[model samples]
Target: MTRVVVHAGFHKTGTSTVQHALAQNRDALAPHLRIHLREDFDPLTASARSWSVTRSDKHFAAIGRNALRFFRSIGREDTRPVLMSSEDLCGHMPGRNGIAAYDAAPDILRVIADNARHWFGPALDLVIYFSTRAPDPWLRSTWWQNLRSTRLTKDLDPYADDLPRAADLSAVVDAVRAAVTAQVVTAPLEDSAARPEGPLAPLLDLTDVPADVRAALGIPPPVNAQPDLGMAEVLLALNRSGLDDEALSDAKRTIRRLAVKRSNLSPHA
Candidate 1:
């Protein structure tokens, strides 16, 4: 039976780094395992996100249809192990669209698993992997990310204190387990970051990518890292500023450029 792994994410947990490494080594890994990243599964992810907000049966049904379509496109005849990674597969990050937790995750995962079973046969080995981080750091990083892209005006301390149970990644994983029968696995970002392949290490292990191919695969430096607290404070101020949309965009671009240059020059960076 073919094995299918889905790295559905808990955001701000080094997900971007994993996706980047996969894209970089796609050619090398192709013979051993087929890889599908967020872009490859956009339609399914979009429907998942929409369903997360609306909680409508219509949107929920769309997720299952999209999953079926994706599997059909890939063809069930090919028996190679397949891996699909997308943070949005579970739903939006907690802070977005007034979402407090991955409340819809169990249902969302059930939809995907049911569709995969229907397409790949009931005997297919399906696994769901969630990359998680410690609560304090995850909340801070999530806040900084929102501050950068969304007009979130809250500072780190308040944001951290105000966060709901979503901060507890273990609970989220438990919820997923309760709702689906697929084998569930988790890799803590802290543990994965210490390995040679960085955040991609745990996944490579799970997929059993050939040892030689693993050695040959390029390990990408961290991508989408959160800025330091100092930089985050500046971003918070920008979000609170009275600038209009166009002006705010230009100002944020300038600030981000400066932050990136500073990060590049830092010895620790």
Candidate 2:
């Protein structure tokens, strides 16, 4: 029987770094585990995100149907443990579309658990893992992300004040535990970032990828890091400028390019 580990997430918690490492080391880890990331579950992730906004039963049902279809397509004869990671599996990050918390996560995860049990049977070993970060940093990072990607005009302080409950990620995890029968595990970004493998340490540990292979795999530099303070301030200003959408996008692109150049030339970088 194959063991399945799903790293559903609380975002701004180094998920991109872990996913990057896994993708970079795919061939090296192939013998011990099979890896799946967000791209492999387009329909499921789409439905999950849709349900996050609409909260319609039909969209919710689509989540279960898509999940089962994805699982069924996997090769049954491959006994190697499967590790799938996607922050979207839970739902949209809080602050997106006025979402205050991962309130829908338990139900979404329950659907996933039910479908997995039905397809993989009683003998299947299923584990759900959540990667979390300290509240202050998580909130700040998430705020910056939204400012960059969306037209969010609020600065970090106000954003944090408005979405206080989003920081209580443990409560979200507890809800998931209550909703699903599979073992639930959590890793703090503070602890995992200090390890030799950086953010990927917890996941590599779970998949039991050999030490030699781990050492040999190329670890990429941090992925999707928040822009520096100066850049962040500029992004906030641009967001509030009320420039036309196309002009706003053009200005942001210019600023981002400059930020990258500055970062690459910095002594710390």
Candidate 3:
């Protein structure tokens, strides 16, 4: 029986850093655990059959199929914990931003469960980890992250009070829990780094990652980690700079609207 750990992300949740660390330490980490860290977890990338999809629209469609294929590709003897990370999968459904109206939200949830069942098989023990912080901070981080990725805007004001209206985040957690044998791990970005032994331990323990391997990685016990602010800012600037005038202008408008709304409706305000 092969164990697969799916790190379905809610975005701006340190997924990239985790993926990066895994990729950097792939060779070292492999001796203890079988880790799949790649664009699509493709065993082969040199061939043209793996025609890369870089555009977001094409990439997402390709990703949906590729994700399932990646899961099914694993064989019985591969006992090492196989890990895959894709933050987009958390909210990549059809209709609403990350959700499509599947008759209703429950149906949408079932859709995710259905996909997981198909990819991982019935016997597979599924664990869903949602790295979360307080709504306010998380929204701030997300706003900045989007800025870096899309070069859309600089107004942090829009996201300053975003946590209160983040109903989708709560919905995602509920939907995932209802959809599969999942556990919701709530974390705060500020305390995540210091409390290295709690929820993070169970996640790592599932892989049977040895002490030596853990030590080699200098992984803390609680692993209460957060995103690097400087790196985040740089990335946001790069992403914002990449946007064309029209897209950038649109992003600015959205940001401004969000800022005003959050401010006016805020309990503190």
Candidate 4:
């Protein structure tokens, strides 16, 4: 039986970094694992201005097809694990006030799992995983990432002044636990920042991949970072500027570049 590992996300977690390493070091990992990044499995899912809850059945069906294809590619080896990752699996993409607020619907996993079983046999080994980060920084980064899509975040106010309710990590875990018969894994990401390899150690442990191989793949550079506090404040202010989407977006990019430059200059940075 082949194990299927799904890295469903709570965004701003080390997801991007983990995904980057998986892609860059695919050759190294192919023997034991084959990772399917979101874009690679395209017709898999879509997020739009209207999807307030979760994805359509069509999306789940696409994923089922991809899983079947991946399962066959491994031939009779069946020992190799098939890995799939898409933060959308968490159903919290445009979270809180963002465009299509995906309230943490645990049921989403059940639906995805049903689709997987249909394609991969009744006894599929699917493990659900999530990572966490400090709330302040996580929320701030999430806000910015969502902002990139003006259609979703147009009217959402800054969470700084009126802090949004804290995410209940325990609740999220419970949801995952209840939604699937598969194993559930969650880890805090504070230690990941200090490690160049991000959170590969824990991920390897989950897939039963060797820990030593982490050093061999080498660390990939970080991707999609959030702005510093000063920059975040500037961004929030800009959000209120009432500029049209075209101009607000242009200004946001300019501000981010400027802020990033200044951030890199300071000794503290």
Candidate 5:
């Protein structure tokens, strides 16, 4: 039976580090499981757009096919664990705003469940692993990495914001949990860094790849990296500057174009 692990995130949660380590150490980890980064298995730059809520046909077709192929590969493999890492698996807009922000929670959850079921085949178990950051810092980190809009965030300090409404997390979790066997594991980034053995144990347990494999993959057993304060300052400045909707959209588009190009040009193969 093929085992599937979906590290659905609470984003800016060190997902990049996890994915990087997994990809880099593929050979060492290959025996226990094959790690599938979205683009490698699927030619489309799957995470280049918010696919769940994206309405564009071109985007949908490219992402959908890749998603299907991802599932098919898992089904065909004899591996003990097939790891799929995408922070987007968790609900986006983990806020109070309604569909105006993104698709409804249920719709997004359904799409994830459908993809997992299709890929893992019948009677699969699911785990939703996540990490926490104090909300303010997490949002600040998000703004930099995604290059979010100035206007939309004008009055708010992401760090000052509350932990996403429990109702919001619950609703999204329930939608996906109801369809499959699910468990929620939360690790605060700081704590995990200080005591990887404590907070990160569960993640390692779930993945069950050897320590050597983890080391080879460079999955730092949780280490501290400086929060790029300059990046955060620029993000905050963008919001404070108040670019209007059209300008913000153009900024976001330009950022995405560059990001996609960079992701495509990666030297790792």
Candidate 6:
């Protein structure tokens, strides 16, 4: 039976970095895993946010259908467990301006389960996986991450400590376990590079990367690791600037070029 492993993201726990790594290593992972990485997990990105925000079931049901279609498009005849990664899956998008969003909305999980069940038959089991970091660092990292990013909210105060703390994730964890009625693994975000399967292995319920395969394929450097502090500070200041949207976009390009040049010139860079 085919199963679904959902990486329902609690953002700022390196979701982008993980997704980047998987995309980069897709060829390497293909023999061991049948992965689906590009589904639109964020509801706000859909064309009908106002309507979706109102009819959550209908909104997520459509997402479930899309996911089913994607699964079939990948030649679903195989019995491989489907691995999916999406920080937006759980839909608890903490606004960039530091606001609390949903702490527990199991109905979204229910929507997916129901739709998937109907499409894939009742025997298809769905499970969830998540990652968390220490609260203080998680809060700070999230603030820095949202500086140049916007979706749920715009114009975060880059210099302020006014960002709200994420709620104890137990609230959502408990909700997910109840919603899915399946095993849920919560992995820590730190020191995961040392793991034999790397950080995402636990999500797939895998223990180790094959030694022979690891030897044969040289793993590339990470794709979307957090930028160094210097670059992050520069990006933050740029985000807080008075420039309009188009000008701000242009300024980001200019700033990135200048930073790269300075880095190359510096002996330590």
Worst 10 residues of 2 by lDDT: 260-269
Ranking of all candidate structures by their TM-score, best first:
2, 1, 4, 6, 5, 3
Error of 1 at 173 (Å): 0.3
Tens-digit lDDT track for model 5 on 1-269? Answer: 55566665555666666666665667776777767775555343343234544545665555556556657655454757767666555434333232222233334444555676776667666666666666556655544544453333433354324434422333445555554445555566667656434333446668787776654444443222223234334544565666776776676555444544554423221
| Residue 30 of model 5, lDDT score | 76
Badly placed stretches (over 4 Å) of model 3 are 41-64, 92-116, 119-122, 151-154, 159-164, 167-171, 181-188, 195-202, 218-269
lDDT of model number 4 = 0.63
Segments of candidate 4 deviating more than 4 angstroms:
47-78, 92-104, 147-166, 194-196, 260-269
TM-score-wise, the better of 1 and 6 is 1
User: Which is superior by TM-score, 3 or 5?
Assistant: 5
State the lDDT of candidate 6 residue by residue for 60-172, as single tens digits: 55666655555445444666666778766655455433345444245555555565666667567667778776766666566555654642233335323443435356567
Weakest 10 consecutive residues of candidate 4 by summed lDDT: 45-54
- The whole-model C-alpha lDDT of candidate 2 against the native structure comes to 0.87
Once fitted onto the true fold, the runs of candidate 6 whose alpha carbons sit more than 4 angstroms away are 39-61, 71-76, 97-99, 151-167, 207-211, 214-218, 231-236, 257-269
- TM-score of model 4 vs. true structure: 0.77
Q: Which is the better candidate, 4 or 6, if ranked by TM-score?
A: 4
Off by over 4 Å in 2: 265-269
Model 2 residue 265 CA deviation in Å: 9.9
Ranking by lDDT: 1, 2, 4, 6, 5, 3
TM-score of each: 0.95, 0.95, 0.61, 0.77, 0.63, 0.75
Model 3, global lDDT = 0.49
Please write out the lDDT profile of model 1 over residues 1-269, one tens digit for every residue: 87899999988998988988899899989888899998898999999999999999999999999999998777666767899999999988888688888898999999999989988886589999999999999998899888878889987787877776879999999999999979999999999999889989888888888788888878878888866648777877888999887888899788777877877632222
Residue 46 error for model 3, in Å? 19
Per-residue lDDT of model 2, residues 106-178, tens digit only? 9999999898888889767899999999899999889988888888988788899988888999988999999
